[model samples]
Target: MDDITEINTKENRQLLYKYLIKMYGKEKAKELMFKHKDNLFGNNSLAYSLGKRSIVFYCLYFLQDYFVPKDDNTVRDLAPVHYDIWRELEDIFIHHTHDKQQFILPRGCAKTSIIDMALSCWLHCYRESIYTVVLANRELDAINFVEQTKIALQTPYIKNTFGELVQPRKRTVNKLELELDNDTKIQAYSSGSSVRGTSYTSSKGKNRVTCFIADDYISEADILSDESKEKKYIKWQKEVEEAGDDPVYRNGKLIKSGTKFIVLGTPLAKGDFIDSIKNDPEYKVFHKSVVPFDPDEYFENHTYWQKFKEIFFDNKRENPLQDAKEYYEANKEYMAFETIWEKYSHFELAKKYFNKKLVFMQELMCDVDNVGDSWFKSNRTMPMKEIENHTFIKTMLTIDTAGVKNKDAKRSDYFAFVVGSLADNDFKYVRQAHLRKFKEFDEYIKHVISLLKENEDITHVYIEKNTYNGLDVDAIKSEMVKHSELMKRDITFINEMQRKNKDDKISTIVDAVNNGRIIFCEERVEQSFLDQVMSFAGQRFSLHDDAADCLSEFANRIDEIEIMKNITTIPRGWLF
Candidate 1:
């Protein structure tokens, strides 16, 4: 039974019809032909009865039956496994390559292998004299496509059919171009230094491409950049759309095969292309595990992969613990994977562990358009609440005016004030706080002083010197003094100099938090203040000296509250 000459000979047609009957049971195959009775036409009634629609069905049915392997070593049999997923992928490639799609996948899936098999099948099985190109982030990865395809073609059935194995040309590195007796050409390329500026069509020609496969097209460099990411994605979209139109003949198929245009890598942060593409509705998304597991309902009751080694590896191997240690030591990347698993696993374990859609949409998949522009780092574990309830005296109130004076800036943290006191052993603790919208410096200062005076613990008032570009501090201080005079209390004003090294300012703040000396009020303390405490790496300090600034000012003005050596315990809840 020959597909190429099934139309040419009546005897050959009979043989092909019998093959189809065996492939799809006679009743089912007959039902399909009967449904397409009007579309079938030819000199031979049975041959003519198989219409265009039936031809497609018959072709697919026969292709599956003739080529797919059923049992173990399916990849070697040159017979396609009748996977519903592979069928859907084929339909998508057949129909939608012209429309650009971005694919997103979790790590350790067989995306690359699937792409390799698809590229080979699309070009070789269909599309005569078609030019096909495969590309990846690097030349080495591109070469792997060629290697994998050669492996696919080396399947026992394919080798038996062709009577020879398809092997890579030794001289032409990073390229595996295969030409059957027909002129169809398959070639691969790495998207590294050699192919960066080179466009595929210019070298391969327009109307010649049957398919273009690109895996991991966007590099890490492009992922990190502002403009480069957009430019690279746009270029890939153009190439795919344009290449999809390059059929060997009109109305012929031009396939672009890959596991979608996956920007494959571990997600580093929020604003990456993988994150961006997962939001797209146009792309048909699928996630299959390189390691398989069951659905969600079934997932919860069992731990398969995690427990596999614990149960089997110890007894299976000579030494189980040593074997586990060796495996863990060999894969350092798994450490990072485990770390992410710990933080994100509660929401993502069902997803990555069991291949389920992450239940939490806001955490797993983010909306691209609604992505945040501003991010604040905060910690609630070692919360500001820890600092909220502490004793303090000789408190100094200090404020750092927001650098910008826009109305919105005024609405934001325009005037950030801290009421801090020097505790025992010279450790300064913040007692009160106020930061909010205000236009007038005197008015803002008045509100701050009024808040402090109500506390009645604050004694010395210190104001940051460089406010409103160093122009308004004097007027601000004078207004504070006038307000005190009206209140009929003589409050001392202290002016503190800013530190030259911002690190020094931060150290002064960190020392207070580290020493458990500063206490915060529950009313104004926040998680962000706590986050600053926890996130103090102590070494790589930058862009976080505001809270430290307030701390430094308090430390500069207040001295230790000295007491008799025998008087060890200070009275609790005493505001001096």
Candidate 2:
């Protein structure tokens, strides 16, 4: 269900039609009904038909029933953002401005249903463009848009206002394509599908594929790799833009504004297709996040946000989401955040997705700094002030080993290791961490032994039972045995197999970091380790997850190792 479009419908529409008949004669009454419909909102079809603003009038009058609500309590009205997009679309179809445009929208704003779907129907009804093509990342999504357009054309007001636009007998109406009565063909295609021969010949003239509406064309596959990203740009150049008549300019004036490429989507990735268009000079861009104000200023030192997160994310509370909604609705003005659309524009709705802040930012705010899902937040990991004199019951080293698979490969996974200790309280402290290439095994071992000496009470060394199994453990033992200083303490070596599901194994770290159970000493931990740990966008999307893997192993095994030691439950290393 959608938020009903808030319109001025205080006056009865059917009763007003009757009044129009009484004021004027029957013929003029019908004319006045067409002219002054739905309180008019200062619009009438008689005056609207003469000018280029037919799109707006049609939407206000014909699509009124579709948007306006029956409930008087629903305060969701059409805001300025809606009219701004309507005028921009009018500029494209009627006024002939820059043909290419992109609308970067917050997710819940209904401007898209007007700009992309309903406007396409108006274009077909007015016979504006001969051949129109709509596209999405998937063909089914494009078909969904086509379905909306088809439904709009058949609406009661639309059919009553403008007679049957669908072809009388031989209408080619289906899921993928629609042929209007005026011989205007509108087809839908997936992003990379063929739209080469998109042209139509009418009695007036032959027009190439002129109106191209691309709505949410960037998919996960499009932004997967560099080659796929390039292919998206190439598709726009060859299929959408190049397939139409090239716009001709004579004297700094656009003589022919050829094709319209309007993209409607929220930014998913940093340099995806919509972002690339935003940087280009030839196209016009309209970007609106959830609110019109600067996000930084609104969220800086936000007082109510923490309480909101606690209440919304609480699983024990019954109807926590509804209770959270009521709380926000009462105190929203005190927060003083203004959404573009009043209620439906994702104002306090971030509480619903507080756990996925990156998604909330990228989807609702169009801030693609961090693309999407983040398992571990870098800021959540606290840093200790000092760690020199702090004594630990037991310190263990976890090494994420990567064998030298191919020396000639452009890039190789790093051998990441983390040294962690269990304190007297239920807190695990990261003593040190570093990463290096697998080629320098000697250097890697030297660093490991050095860390061992630094953390002298190192009880055990654990390695994943993979590549560096048998001789590698022995080599480390030999190096430690050579040092007379390390001869006092006895160390255990274990080559253990890890769980196959990496994300499932690493799931505990999220709560551990968020709840302050784990701390990282910034002085000892390398920046590379922190970066890999934070940028691990779940399910192995990062270039190298060795550092994250090492941290996960270290965190999971801390309690088990303390149990093996049978350490006193009184102080540090009490199975933190």
Leading candidate by lDDT: 2
lDDT for each residue of candidate 1 in 1-576, tens digit (9 for 90 to 100)? 123333334543444456448547888767755654432223223432332113233233323333334453343232122243344444545544433343343342344654445435444534422556666778777666776665565543233224233533422323555544333456776654333232323233543454555566655566444566666556655554344442233355444333233233333224454444544575555433222333323433444434433422222244544554455455434422322112233323432322212212222332223222211122112234554444444566676665444655422443556776664333445656544556655566567657655656565666666554445545545566666543564455565455454433444444334323344555565445444435443223233435545555565556632222235677877756
- lDDT score of residue 554 within candidate 1: 60
Model 1 deviation from native, Cα RMSD in Å? 16.7
Give, for candidate 1, the lowest lDDT window spanning 10 residues: 373-382
Q: What is the C-alpha RMSD of each candidate to the true structure, in Å?
A: 16.7, 9.9
TM-score leader: 2
Mind giving the per-residue lDDT tens digits that candidate 2 earns over 1-576? 111233223443443445445446679868766655543332333323422354555665667655555464443567888878887887887888678888999887875476877778777766676788888878888788778888778865555445577753677878888888777878888876888877776666788876888888887667655577778877787777888776678998876667777888887666778888888788899998886665545553577765665566443465656776777778777655567777553435555235444555677788775543566764333445555445566689888887765575546777888889886544678888888775556776787788788877778888887776666777787887888877767777778766555654665576565434567887888888888887787553566678878898898887788534555567667759
